[model samples]
Target: MSVSELEPGDREFERTPPHDIPAEQGVLGGMLLSQDAIAEVIEVLRTADFYRPAHQIIYDAVLDLYGRGDPADAVTIAGELTKRGEIARVGGAPYLHTLISSVPTAANAGYYARIVRERSVLRKLVETGTRIVQMGYNADGADADEILDRAQAEVFAIAEKRSGEDYVPLSEIMPGALDEIEAIGSRGGQMVGVPTGFADLDALTNGLHPGQMIVVAARPAMGKALGLSTLVPTPEGWTTMGALEVGDEVLDADGRPTRVVAATEVMHGRPCHEVEFSDGEIVVADALHQWRTSVAGVTAVRTTEEIAATLDEVHVIDGPDGRVTKIVDVRPVASVPVRCIQVDNTDHLYLVGRSRVPTHNSTLALDFARAASIRHGLTSAFFSLEMGRNEITMRLLSAEARVALHAMRSGTMQDEDWTRLARRMSEVAEAPLFIDDSPNMSMMEIRAKARRLKQQHDLRLVVIDYLQLMTSGKRVESRQVEVSEFSRSLKLLAKELQVPVIALSQLNRGPEQRTDKKPMVSDLRESGSIEQDADMVILLHREDAYEKESPRAGEADLIVAKHRNGPTATVTVAFQGHYSRFVDMAQ
Candidate 1:
C-alpha cells in the first residue's frame, strides 16, 4: 500500500510485517550485516579466502582481465567467478552481479584496490572481528559510528603490519645496475689517476686525485701559497678566461716585468699611417711596422649607426692604426674554431684559488679549523717522520742512501740516526695526499670537485693548507663566527670529498703557558668547530724556536692531540732551517 493511503496509527502497533520474517533469515539477514557489505565481502575474499583455490582462481582471472586492458562487466565477472567454484547457488551468477553492481562505483573501486595492494593489511583488519553497518536502502537504520570505528581500527592494524621491519640489500635487489661503463665516461679520454709529489705523504695518503679540495695551510711564512704555486702549470700551456692583473708591475716567470710593444712597429720601421674616405672606409700604409699586416675588409653605410652592423669573422679595418679608405664587400674567414684551453697564469691561479672559499658563516669555519687541527695533529704525530724523509728524498737527494751521506756532510744529525730516520720515513711516504688552498670553498664546489675527480680521474686523497687563512667573505662580523663556518664547511667537504682534508691551523697563546709547549685542540684559534669536525688534530711544537740558541737544536715534536681514526702519539722530526722543510727522526 502507498504511504499516503495508509492511516498513521491504523496498523496494529508493534506487529512485524509478513515479508520481514524471511528477510530476517539467510541472505536478507547477511545483507543487513553492514553499510559497506559489498566492500566487506570483497576484502574478505581478497585476503583471508584468497589462499583457497576457488578464491585464487577468481582473483587471478579478474586481475588478468584488468592487466590486459579489458573492461570488467558483470556477465564476464560472473562467468569467471563461477568457473572458480566461488558460487554454489543456481542463480548465484546473476545474484552476485546484482550485488556487485548495486555497490557504489567509487566506494567499490577504492576498497578493491586497497585490498589488492595491501593484502596483509586487510587480513589483519578482518582478524580483529570488526563490526560494520549495512549501507543499502533496505537497511537504513544502522549504527554508522560503530561501523566506522571498526573499519578504521582494521585499517590501522593493517598499516602497522605493512610498516613492520624488513631489510633488503641493494646488491640482491638490483644486480649490475651500478657497474661502470668506461665508454660513456666524462671528459672523453682523460684518465683518472693520483698525484705522486711526495713519498711519506703519499704513504699516509695514496696520492692527490683530480677534483679534490686539498687544503695546504701554514702560518705567515709557512710556504702555503708557494706550495700551491708549484702545482699548477707555469710559464705556458695554461689558458685564462679573464684578464690577468699582476701587482703594479707585470712580471714573467723569471720575475722580470714585461714591456708592451706594438707587433707591427717591431716588424716594420715606421708607425702605420691612415687616410679616411667619404664612404666611411680607411686606407693605411705601414708606418709603425709590426709582425703581422693585412687590410682584410670593410662595410659602407650612409649613417654612423650602420658601421657596427658587421660580421665578427670578417676583418673590417686595413691594419692597426691604418684608416678605412674604401668600403669593400668580403666573405668571412672559414677557419675552424680553436678550443681555447685556459693557461694557469698568476692571475688565473689566483682566481681558481679564490673560488674555493666557503660561505661566510659561523658554523663552517669552526668546523673546518677543528677538522684541520685534528687531521694535522694526527698526521703530524704519526706520519711526520715519514713525510720529512719523503720530502727530502723527492725534492733533494734522489735516493735513501744519499740522505745519510748528505746528513753526515751537513752535520744536521748523526749518520746512524739519520740513516734510521730515512729508512722509516721512506716506508711511510706511500699513501695519497691532496691539498686545497681555496679561500673559503662552498659545499657545492667541494662536492662537485670530489665527484668530478672520482668520476673523471678516480682520485681519493686530498688536503687543504692552513684553515684560518681561508676567507669566507668580507661580510663576516666576528672572527668566531667565521671560523665556525669554515670548520663545518671543511667537515662536510671532507665527508663529501671522501678524502682527508689536512688543513693547517694557528694556535692561540695558550701554548705559551707550559714549558713543554705543545699546542692542543683547545688552542685552535677563534672557533671550536675545528675540534667538533676534525677526525684528527696535530700540533707542530718547536721548543728550540721559543728559546734563543737553545741546546735542543733542530728538534721539533709533532704532537697528536686528537686521532679520530687511530691511536694518538707524538713523533720527532728534524727541522731543516735552511730549506724550510722537515725530516724523519733517526731510529
Candidate 2:
C-alpha cells in the first residue's frame, strides 16, 4: 500500500518504510561509472542506505573493489559479488548493467546519495518510534520518567548514527595522504610535529607527529603548594592574595617588578598559620607556604609549619627589604581559602602585605601541551585523569610564561614575572588548548570525548596524563590484560583521528634498583603491551632526582627508548624545575 493512502487508524506496518528506489539505483550506477562519483557517494550512503536488498549487495561490492584500490566499474563489482557468491542475489551482471543505464550522468551522484540518506534517516526514525512505543506498552511497573529518558536516548541514537563514519574509498583519501608525505619530504626531513621546544629532543624524534602514540613513563613525586588572603604588590598597587591571576605583576626579591607566570584558583578550607613579626607586622599562610628567614646568621627557606614547630628558637626575618624583625610568635590558625602564584625571578621570592613580608615559593616539573599549543600554534586536547583543570592550567601558564611554578602556586609572584607573563598571555589565552580532568574515567568515555573534541576543535594532539589510571570498563582476566587492551585502543584512536596521542605512564620502580636510576622501556608498568602498542617510548630521567649531588643536577635526559621510525638516543635538555618547563640548554 502507498504510504500517503494509509489512514491513521489503518495498520501502518503493512505499508513500505520510507525509501527512494530510483535514487538508490542512481547512486550505485554513478559510483560504478566514475571514480569521482564513488568518492562522493561513499561518504553519504552506506550499504544499508539502499531500499532494495539487491542494490545493497551491489553497493557493498562496489565499495569492496574501490577500497582494495581496484576499479568499481560494473565488471569489477560483478566479479567482487561473484567472489562473495552474491551475484545471483543481486540479480546478476544484467541488473548491474541496468543500473548504469538508468543514470543519465555521474555528476548527480552526490544528490542521489543525499536522497538515499534522507530516506534511510526517515526509515530509522520510524523504526526507533516503533521500538519506543513497544517499550511504553510493555513497561509493566516501569516509571514514566524512565520511559521518557529511554525515549530521548532512542531518538538521539539516530543523530549519532547520522554523524558516524562509513566505509570509504581510498581514492578519496590518497590525495591528502600523498600531499602530507610530499610536504614532509619537502622539509628535507625536518621536524613535522609539535616541537617540544627542546632542540636535542626535537632533533632525535623529528617532533611529535600525528597518528603516533608516544608513551612517557617516569617514577613518581614532584610538585609544590600556598594561602589566599596575603597581600601582593603589583605595578598598580597591593592586591589581596585571591585577587592575583596569571599575567599579573608583583615585586620580586631584588625589589624589581617581575611578571606572574602562573596563578591557581582559591583552594578553600586549607590549614593556615599566623606569623607575628617583632615589628608588630603579621602574615597568615598555609602550612606549606615558605618564608625566607635567618637563624644564627644562616639563611634558608622554611615552610610556615616548619617555622611554627621551631618557634621556641629565635628566628629573624632576613628579607630583600633589609628588615631584621625577630619572630615573636608563630601559631596555627583557622583554615581558610588560599591561592598561589609563581614568578620569573631567580630567587623566587616576593613581598607581601604592608610590612613587605618576604615569602618563598618552590619549583615543580613540566609537560608539553602548552608548548605544542601556545608555541607551535597547534590545537591540542589534554585529558588529565590525575590532575584537575586548574592544576593543568597552572602548569601551562608556568611553562609558557617561564615563571616559577611554586611562586605561582604560593601567591608570591614578582612584577617582572607579571610583565613576562603579560607578553605571552595572549598566546596562552588564544591557543586552542583544552583540558578534561574527570577522574577515574574509562577508556570508552575518553575516546567519546576525544572524538567530540576533535570534531569541534580539530584537535591536533591528545595527551592522557597517565595510562595506568584509566579503566577499560570491561571485565578482564588481569590488570596487565586490561592495560594491554587500553594501549591497543589508544593506538587505534591515534590512527582513527590521524593525530598524535601521548599517554603518560608510570615506571615499576625497577629504575630505582639500577645504579644509574635510568628508566627503561621494560620499566613501563605493563611493559610488553605498552612497548608493543606505542609508536615511540620516551623515558624521563633526572640524575639529581636520584643522586642529589650528581654532576647533571639541572639537566634531564629524555631517553628515546623505542622509536618505530628512527634511531634511539638520549637527548639532554635543561630541566627548569623552577619554571616547570624544559628548554634547550642554550636558553
lDDT for each candidate structure: 0.38, 0.72
Estimated TM-score per prediction? 0.32, 0.58
Per-residue lDDT over 1-587 for candidate 1, one digit per residue giving the tens place of the 0 to 100 score: 76556676754323332221111112211222233433344434332323233334444445444445554445665676677665553245555444444444433443443444454444444444323223223346544443443354344335433322246557433433333334326536332324222233333433333223333221111001111112211122222222232222222322123322211111223222222221212223232112121224223322211222332322233311122112232112112111111223332212111111211111112222222223222121111101222332332222223343223333455666566657645443532223333323543344445444544443444444345545544456776787677777667655543555555565554665666555676877667777777765656666654443346666666565665544666656665432223555565
lDDT of 2 by residue, 70-187 (tens): 9888898888888899999988899889999999999999999999999998998998888898998999987665476557645644654553235556975786699889998999
Residue runs of model 1 more than 4 Å from their true location after superposition: 1-447
Candidate with the greatest lDDT versus the true structure: 2
Provide backbone clash counts, one per model: 105, 27
What's the C-alpha lDDT at position 496 in model 1?
Answer: 43
lDDT of 1: 0.38
